[model samples]
Target chain A: MSDHHEDLPPFCHPVSTKLLFGVFFGLIGLTILTVATSALGSALGMPPAFAFPLAMVIATMKAFLVCAFFMHMWWDKSFNVLAFLSSLLFVSLFIGMTMIDTGEYQPTIEAFDINNLANVEVSE
Target chain B: MAVADSHNTHDDHHDLYDHGEFIAHHFDSAEQQFDSGKLGIWLFLVTEVLFFSGLFVAYTLYRTNHPEVFEQAHVFLNKYLGGLNTIVLLFSSLTMALGVRAAQLGRNKNCSVYILITMVCATMFLGVKAVEYSHKWDMGILVRSAFDLTYTHPTPTTEIGKSLHISDYLVYLCVVPALLLAGFLVASVISKLVNKATLAKFMMAMTITVSGYFLGVVIGIIFMNATEGETGSTHASVIVEQPLMLMASTQDDHAADGDHEDGDHDHDKAAAGSSHDGEHADHEEHFGSHPADGGEASFDAHHPDPSTLSRDVGIFFSIYYCMTGLHAIHIIAGIIALAWVYWRCLLGHWRTDYFGPVDYVGLYWHLVDLIWIYLFPLLYLID
Candidate 1:
């Protein structure tokens, strides 16, 4: 058994630069897409709130292309992808909780009457 | 297509082949060494993600307090440039992946070439961003204390418009792009310069490009602040009245005039309350030593509603600088790391079993691109 053993062959060929350049131009194209769609979204009667989100969604697509193709996350280990995803989930949760708190916290504007000069504090 | 051919095995299985002095005596085979190396790299990358998380949290808290300020300030950013950079980064990432692939197949020459191309794309991305940022400086958009208050609130035609308090967004935007580009360029130039076999006159060109950006930003910031300081005075009344207009304009259509009446009533109540206080003071002072000093002319002569415009403006640009500025720092760091990897590759230092450092850093480079995707919309695409 020692005399006859099976082992993985050393990989000898790596990727080429041509494909990398293709990714580069692709990113440029996506940037153009982001600019065009964002402009169109603003002009197409959408509210700024909604329009901006939609534009972000398009940008995210471009980002995904870079991550998966250029960054080679698609070819990397599954664990790396998992690590990235979990971090994103945790960040989203943090943002969500803070936004909730901010939305609920009553602003102090109601406590002070603008006309009550005696109660007002001014800094020169 | 024979079974005998499929069962073929190599002779190098159990035999310890001593090839060089650097090989660790503890490792059994090259395959084990390679996989472990890659694993070690991924672990290090996890730490990097955690580090960046701190900055991201800061952004969320500030954004929540002043959504409108953040929104208005974001409009001042250049989405086209950011989007283009994102694309450039993504393409570089792809090239990086291909480079790794080529390495795995034992094509060292091909791997080095791919890395060089990736570096070029990164350079181009930075070049575009530099041009875009120069324009912003010309427009007086950096977040120093004396930036122009050109972005007036739409409704506050009477008072001041809503400005967010987050100050770091603009800084994040400018710094991140510049940093990423500079880091990559430096890494490339340094590695090439150190190699005596390939050293040439190219170092001078690289030095010029690096110094040019530094000088430009310093001058731009100084000039912008000076101009703004000279003509920086804003009308306070506008700040106080803009919110009221926004509130009036956004009310239900059927109750539009009703809301307007209510708002006018509130304004009158505010005025009446002020005058009432002034009168009350006059009466109360009759019993005091300063009774004869009850002349209300001094108080009433210059009563302008304390403008919140400055506060709003300050808040808006603050977040603007923080968010974009933080992101910019990350970009610069990523560029430096990428450049380092390219340098190693150029020196023929990496082999199929030890490119994990390059691979993981590329992972991070992609994240910088991802963040830009979100920022471009949040800042530049505002309607």
Candidate 2:
């Protein structure tokens, strides 16, 4: 190992200094972009639904940069990448199921609120 | 498979087991050990994601059901502070990545420096979080009993009112531990001076004393909760007070103008009631005096309707505290991990051939940053 100091293992892909700096600045720029876009979206009176998804898109991009370069997941093992990405898939499923349930109850909830108001008025 | 096997055989001469000193005997090779550890950390990160996913689910459900509540409550959060924390965590992630790189290059000094910087950023992040939490506490916008609802209604039988008053004496909880630790340290020094104790004995005593103090705190909290339960004081009874007045005051001057006719009637009634109760809720006078703080100012400037302050808004704050509190716990863990790796780097434990610890810690730190990346916009930049 001492004699072959110049030889790196086939798996070891050390990122270049220039690339690390580039990623760092890129992250900072994206941070500013997220804030600017959100602020701009609000100022322009964009709907919350549209503004939120746009902001999330920027956040997803930032997260990808961090995971790929900063975390070295890009050049690392495919199993690790799959392991991490699977969590997002599960998260989407969780969110989706909950959204479906909440949507189903929306009308019932609204009716309940109106019923409660009528009861309050009658009691008063 | 055959081509890969041939390539492996071609590089067989370069396969050095000199990593034997650092590599566990159970592993076939250095690469195998590193890969196994990397896999383990990735799996752990997966668990971390799921752990926080539950909170995200709650956030999504609540925001979906009550968008107005989130919009109004989120106004209390300082976006500049949140943005600053986001940048700090991002920089820490950069330093952590660089730290791992430095370790990979056998630059122990630079590795330690980067790790130290990462730890500093973690501390700054926690400091900012503390400021935000304390501000929330002062504004009576906390979870459950932590909120100072007694400011407008001083119910004598309410457990939260009693608990809120006790917070003034929470400083005393620190006294016992400080005294215990100090007494042990002083006694240890005296024993050493008199040659009655070895250095090892003194060090053990100090450790035992610190652990004892923490144990005391845990036992104390358990006892408090048990006694509170015995008294049949349900946690939910401590409802938010001055809700209407606070909500009305939170509206913008212009918005209030349009609703002035009706708002004035409710405002006068609520204000009169609150002031009358305020005279008796002297314990809450500290928070009551600061009605025009930055949070309120911002709330007035970008006011949501008073209707947004329905009781459900407390759920928004409750979710906020839980998510951010859990995230802060992760930040503390990352800080401890970085500090440990930094200490090891200073002792020359990591080098070009065995930088797995630095790499793993860097991965953990990046995950922490990743969580904050989503949390910031979701909680603070709500449209």
Candidate 3:
């Protein structure tokens, strides 16, 4: 309904078909990368444990593709990006705290018998 | 019916109630309230991810000490089924994103179509998973007794198509958790039915119940496959001497022979037993265990060995369950949101100017599908 639609930024308009096509191919490329990395790791004798990280890295890349384009994160308000990033930050904190709590060590302590010190003088 | 404007008597309408000015005496605009709700949702999702992360980390430590167990277990998962689920979820994500786009553009008809497509894809993913799980169950693959391990389908050598790729140990770990998830989903559905909830609740309950029954059948088949003497649905015991059965097969000859010298066999058995204990202690020891193993064994059993396994394994299953369960939960939530949106859409509450809630829900739905895209491959496919 506006007379000067040309004055508005491109992002404010509908996304271009080329960009949609790019997303499609990018998704395919990412999937290939995920499979390739996983196969490479396994072929190199990496265990099942390594497969997860490889898969995760691949997943992160694929998710980035969807988020940046399909989800329109690239064109979203900076505030929205900040909000989403905050969630991720909290997630990191959660993982870190769990690791720390689970990783704590309880060392064994023994009482020294000083009453027999004369018979066995402490030798360093 | 014959109401009159009372203010007209004195013509003092300036003292009228300002409905617009009433802001519940709390927040600013409606947008601020909505933004706060979104923030709350994000915070909740973060906590959810964190909770699953703990499980992942625990799995990682266990895998480190039991590399063989992890490797052997990995084979039990059906990569093909997982890949199919991945593709299904990826497509669902696309549909969900399009649905959100449709809502943002105020195209309610298009939004509905896209959402329907998304729901279909989700259903398909669950369906394929059901088939694969059933195959495992029919094979007697669910981890219950160690006796299940001794039974192997002879076709793995001749017919490559029917090869049992999954390891016995992994079946217990992965399939058991999967069954637990199925049970939870069913429980959620039953709880909804008990509440005598709305139409959206009924639809969701129907979906989960059907899926749950399928899952239970699949699990039952896997248990059946493990039994030797019985047919498809029967549980008749296959009469065979336990020790002799283990011995006749050269595969487990080492288990029966125990022929190593006193020191070496003792060391090997101890090492194998200790590593197995460290990784899988959570399942058995967490419940109950006799105080027979030495002090070190008992101590390590009580304290999960997080230091030993690859951190990613724990992270994988952690994300696996969280992503899948969260997505399933969201599917149900989306149905409820859709029901509300349906009411609003029917009422013409949305137009070209304001359709943010519908659009945002669609965005969240896309996210749910997106997470599953990764989960399928990480859990089911990649060896």
Which number leads on DockQ? 2
**Which is the leading candidate under lDDT?**
2
**DockQ for each numbered candidate:** 0.29, 0.35, 0.19
lDDT of candidate 3 over B254-364, digit per residue (tens): 332332211222343223433353344343322123222112221232332322122212223333444455556666576556545544543444433234566566556
Give one digit per residue, the lDDT tens place, for model 1 in A1-124.
1111122234222334565667667666766776777678756766766765667676767767666666566765687677756766776776676667653424343343434544534410
Candidate 3: how large is its RMSD?
A: 12.1
User: Candidate 2 residues B108-216, lDDT tens each?
Assistant: 8788778867776776676556545644554467763234431221222435326644232233434544675677677767767778644434333343534443443
lDDT of 3 by residue, A1-124 (tens): 1213242222233344457557756776767667666668767877756777767877787878877777677876667667766766765666566556643432310121223323333431
Model 1 regions more than 4 Å off: A1-29, A107-109, A112-124, B1-67, B105-113, B120-140, B144-147, B150-195, B198-306
Candidate 1, residues B1-383, lDDT tens digits: the string is 11222112144432345222223557654445555665665555555555555555655554544444454345445454555456555666666677666655435566667666665665555555554454444334455343433322122111111142211323444465467447646665775768743332223333343443444344433443343322122212222332221222112233333333343334542333323433344332221222222111112212322122223333445555666666667766765676566556656655444455565666666666666666666566665
Q: Give the candidate order by descending DockQ.
A: 2, 1, 3
Per-residue lDDT of B167 in model 3: 30
Interface RMSD per candidate: 8.5, 5.7, 9.0
Q: Over the stretch A1-124, how does candidate 2's per-residue lDDT look in tens digits?
A: 1213345554455677688888888888988888888778778988988989988898889899999999998898898999999999999899999878765643433333321444634544
Residue-level error in angstroms, candidate 2, position B293: 32
Order by lDDT, highest first: 2, 1, 3
TM-score of chain B of each: 0.54, 0.61, 0.50
